[model samples]
Target: MTDRRGVVAKRAEDLMPGVPYVRGWNRARQSASALADQLVLLGLDSDFPGLVADVNVVGDGLVQLGTVRPEAAELLATLIAAGLRAELHGTTAETPATARREAPAA
Candidate 1:
């Protein structure tokens, strides 16, 4: 049987799924900061703390969406997807400072 620590570790691994490649708009370097803030507001900060980062794609693309850690890729992708869908439904982004004010106190 696995130990308690092992079980918890395994669960964390399972909960952290794989990330998808999110491209299209919002890839511009200038947009990276806003993207990261969106991720944080969407509750992705628990998984990726730093913020949305601007990464260079190997091929021709205006922008790229990926995680520094393989595990975080999935959550990041989900966040982006949700954001896109929201925009499609006429959603507007909340400002970084505004989001911070609304975040649950630690």
Candidate 2:
């Protein structure tokens, strides 16, 4: 499992190579919302209700799936079958410290 911090840090570094942070973040969030809607339309909400509740965007190109349930694999497989690139990042027990850490200033 890859460290969540490292994954977050890498994403932070690579965020919007030439774009403004706010603009980039807003774009990503919008895209994530659209993707989430698409997933719902694809019946993921019905197929894996619990897992679907945990899908969220933490950064550009970074959709975080916050679950350790076995169904997560099935959800990922479904996403991949739909031609979406989905992969497991490391899992960690979420805590206040981790949750409160802000992304590095751009």
Each model's lDDT = 0.45, 0.43
Clashing pairs in 2: none
30-71: candidate 1 lDDT, tens digit per residue: 576666565666655565554433322221113334435664
Weakest 10 consecutive residues, lDDT, candidate 1? Answer: 8-17
Question: Which regions of candidate 1 are displaced past 4 Å?
Answer: 1-29, 49-67, 82-106
Candidate 2 CA-lDDT value: 0.43
TM-score of each: 0.31, 0.39
Candidate 1 lDDT at 71 equals: 49
Residue-level lDDT of model 2, residues 64-104, one tens digit each, is 44443455445445445434222243343333233224212
Residue pairs with colliding backbones in model 1 are: 18-74, 19-73, 19-74, 36-52
TM-score of 1: 0.31
Best by TM-score: 2
Model 1 residue 64 CA deviation (Å) reads 7.3
